[model samples]
Target: MSDIDLDSARPIFIAECRELLASMESALLRLPQEADKDRRDSVHGIFRAAHTIKGSAGIFGMEDIVSFAHAMESVLDHVRDGVLPIGDDLIALLLACADHLGQLVDSVAENQAQPDAELVHDARPLLAQLNQRLLAVRMQRSPGAGDAPQRKAPAAPRQTGADHWHISLRFGRDVLRFGMDPLSFLNYLQRLGRITTLVTLHGDVPLLDGLDPEACYLGFEVALESSAPLSAIEGTFKFVMDDCEVGILPPGSPVADHLTLMRERARGDPAELQRLRAIWLHCASVAPEALDEIAAAATKPAPAQPVPAPAAQPAAAPAPAPATVRARRTGPRPGEASTVRVDADKLDRLVDLVGELITASASATMAGRGLRSAALQEAHEALALLVQEVRDSALQLRMVKIGATFNRFHRVVYDAARDLGKDIALEISGEDTELDKSLVEKIADPLTHLVRNAMDHGIEPPALRLAAGKPAQGTIRLNAYHHSGSIVIEISDDGAGLSRERIIGRARSQRLLDPGREPSEAEVFALIFEPGFSTADAITSLSGRGVGMDVVKRNITALRGSVSLASRSGQGTTVTVRLPLTLAIINCFLIGVGGSVFVLPMDVVEECIDFIDPGANDYTELRGQVLPFIRLRRLFGVQDTPPRRQSLVVVGHGSQRFGLVVDRLLGETQTVIKPLARLFAHLRGISGSSILGSGEVALILDVAALADITRAAMVSRSPAAAAAEPVHQG
Candidate 1:
């Protein structure tokens, strides 16, 4: 009903596969530090994700894709078992395999008929090594500790006589719903032979009232006549069965004798077997080896020791428990709970519906402002309240935790620091910070650049650090939190801070600064954000490109956010990023500028007060705070005369504070953002616009940008700023 194209499931598969691949890459990179036994979980998670995609591909009959994924999965299985040791070289090979698998998946998803043969050829060498190891191990021993494989193999090769084999399969009580799809194996059997007999067992089927439709209730005793080898039949179920409970008993068995045994076992059910015989006569008999192969698969491995110890005696304590292996044939890893696939577009539609509901409720409240009936008024108020709750609940669905995004920095830091040969440690904090999904998606690029720069430049080389009387291993700390109604992410390095002198030299050499003017330390750091500026001594893949950090600043700005740097020469440098909690709705204080109304975010507003003190008239000595204040009317060239008493609004960022002079302080208003038109894109001081009750638009002031401009102006001591009148209000 979703209108999703079933054939297009490939692209979804590709995306999910890529995410799984990244997870695997990250997990593998962490393995050296992780104890081997503790890695089973990571291995299992990766294996299941791959296995699911492969099975889905098979349903579409994607031959090459299925075969390739199976090969990679075989390698992962070896890693899962204790037989193969995981090491750096093997992990590197697996990583490469993961990447290729992604490409193949993408090719299939995009409806490209075939994947690149070059990729397959490139991967052959590694797959062959894996195969060689598998062959080596298989050749060394038979299944079930010497007996299972030897007996099963000799019988399998000789089973070519008939096309059908009678199979009676009774699964263990614990088999998962699809754990033993007698049908999947049956279908594979049918591929080789014809199904001559089918007897469905209803004994295990529950009373109609108690039955679970999803549960497999019926078992089968089947008779198939086919020419396929016994090995193919055995391999189909190999992934699942510990005890197959199968009997090859193909069509060529002594007719009279087999019938007598079946009659005895059936206890008077003659009709089913009689019907089976009629179908069996038309097809070529199944192979004798097939019968034996089924028997071998059905048998369980014998216990090392079958006797139990006496309750009181320590009876020669058993050897350490071997890692238990329980093989279950499953199409995919079980999910947290059963779920149905849904298109993202549908979810977006639902969100939009909820937004409209909120808008309608607001409209209704406005329309019924003076309703005379008590009952009607109460009804309207309750509906408005319910709609408000619904709006919040809908938006919360798009709120995702930042933990996954934060954890990826571990691998990035590890790989980059090693490439630079600098010993550095990445420390993470506050991964539980929550943000809008859109913001999380947009922020990944900027965060990556900052982390790469820290690893490549901020951290000193190990030997250099030791000689400088510091810890040999430096640390890069990523911490985030919700502060002042905004999300703050801090990436700080406890290595040498920004080299002020070196940065200034690089900027001057690159013609990014005035020829002979001395730049302050802060100014020197700020210059790094100028296009094409970097302080690296040599060009390298990680940092010498000189193309990343500046773009990082610009992108953060575009997010209605701000980023700034704070460093102590030898202490450390921290890049602080402050972003709005949500892009959609914000609470603001309305202020008038040049006859047009604008809004300042309430979170950053410290206080609003009227100044009566005559000392406030001077540009100094207002509450002992020396910071100069800017008036709204004058800054924007508003020519109107000022009101008798002007209100001062104090805004704070960290320890800094400044005042804005406005004609009036309008009460708080809740509004939703409406982006400005593209032509006015360079509107610097105004970040965004929102609609008012009267259908008028008010600009949202960019507080952080304004603060930066104020700081820059104060530092420069511009002649224009000094010439203007100041209220000295703080």
Candidate 2:
């Protein structure tokens, strides 16, 4: 491959290595929880992931990854064979190795020729740990070997004239067509041991005029001198096994096996059989006597018994174990869905084009309405439907399941609980919920902070849990589901819940809350999210400088989302994060205030009503309920005078309801969200901007921020105004 091709392929290799590392870590985590029968499958999966990574890294000439993955694969190989027992210590060591491997892959992503000095230093102990494990396993397997030294002495050199393992390979014609280079496998084989001799055969190659450039018609006979197991040698070709025929003859093997390999390769052609026999005898250094004995035995037919009936034949003979393992590691089974990995930039560009198309479609529709042409209007109505479908399809391509993101918390909870010396288990539900890919990526950090906080602060210690009449092993639950056109993620823990008194006291000491004022449960709980507010008596590594929760709130808010905290005195606490399905475009309820247009996410808008009480402001009675309202004209400082009639759009955010007073109800429309420039980022009550069909820019309202403003406005009202009856607005 050219330098350009290699540069382009490096990202793919890096991405695949990361995915494999993730799979390896997940499998290692599950080892302790799986049953004996199921545990074997997991072990195989982990081994295959490591093996594939090493092979790919070798192809990329990434020596760091290859060496580390090779060491990890050795230990995993023993585990798969039941030589090393599964235990907590082994799993922990392997998880650490997986982490180190991830770091190596990160270096590759950065185009570093090798891991930096710090990473190299970090890898020493991990590699040492792997070597120690393998040494221990070997000691345990050896007969009469007890209390062996930590470091074994080097073995004596191999004697001269020793027989070598002979390997025969004949690649299928389509090998090159599938983007595989035959020499790469041979290079990987060198990692196992020395290849003393290699002979390439081109007997199958046609004349120059008849040859196809893309077809592979070559074979190889290799004399390898190594002590590596047969399985390891076979695994060198695992990725291409389906498209190649491989035969291995170990030293000291019976002559019958060699004869069988030769016959299989030669098929039924006498000339080819003779050619193979001669090559094995001369080139592969096979004994002539052994071949003659095998030939004589094959020529003499043995006495046969009566042939069995068709039904008496064995039904579906078992396949070789190695073949079965390879099958599992290959691509998905028949009838299963396969995926093509696309770059995130490409997906983003596609979404951007779709958004532009939506704007154009809306503009065309508006033009058609002005012309009052029935034919054009009818055609555009159809075009509008098609555009809607295209918009949905384009967005759907970016929608990924949240399960992968949620599963990542398993390791987080595990490590945190271990460090805190607490017994906590993460229980997941509704993991199959789907959300925008962008949201999934951005929400992970916030979710991690929330999870760690729950483990550190929310979940009580084992002794405390027992005293409180709860299970000694506390539980942290991550549940996700879609509701009201939004994805709701709930992270709850069954430990001592948030203490209202403690929170309020902390808030007051920090001057975040007034000393004499009382607040609702929701309001008290929300104080924890205030910057630099903490109820902890002392600082801890995980949290307690009061930095995480505030950032969590800020991040969720920036995503056009809302976070709410609900807790009981002793029951537990649940942090609920609600976010729109996609950030690029949305169905919005457009309203006009003093000739200025604003967009309210359609999901949050409950209903619209005419403002009946013109005399009242800020507070209104909606069907006997005290509904706090914000007048858009006053909020955005629109200079146009209000008309005689105004509209109130009631919207619900989390547990609060607020009404936005506007001058005109524009109904619903599809709005493509365009982010505001950095200069306008500090503006409150507006999350983004959008361009309408009339070429006018409309501000996308931040519903949560507006709700907060409404609450603040209601709280500032005078005692007499508060005591006054709210004007009926229904």
CA RMSD (A), model 1: 11.5
* Worst 10-residue lDDT window, candidate 1: 147-156
Badly placed stretches (over 4 Å) of model 1 are: 1-5, 8-16, 108-384, 470-472, 515-518, 611-628, 717-730
**Candidate 2 lDDT score at position 121:** 71
lDDT of 1 by residue, 637-671 (tens): 78877778877777765445676777877777556
List runs of model 2 lying over 4 Å from the truth: 143-242, 245-270, 273-333, 621-626, 712-730
Reference-based TM-score, model 2: 0.79
lDDT of 1: 0.65
Model 2 poorest 10 in a row by lDDT = 319-328
Tens digit of per-residue lDDT, candidate 2, span 464-520: 999999999999999999877889999999889988888888788889998799986
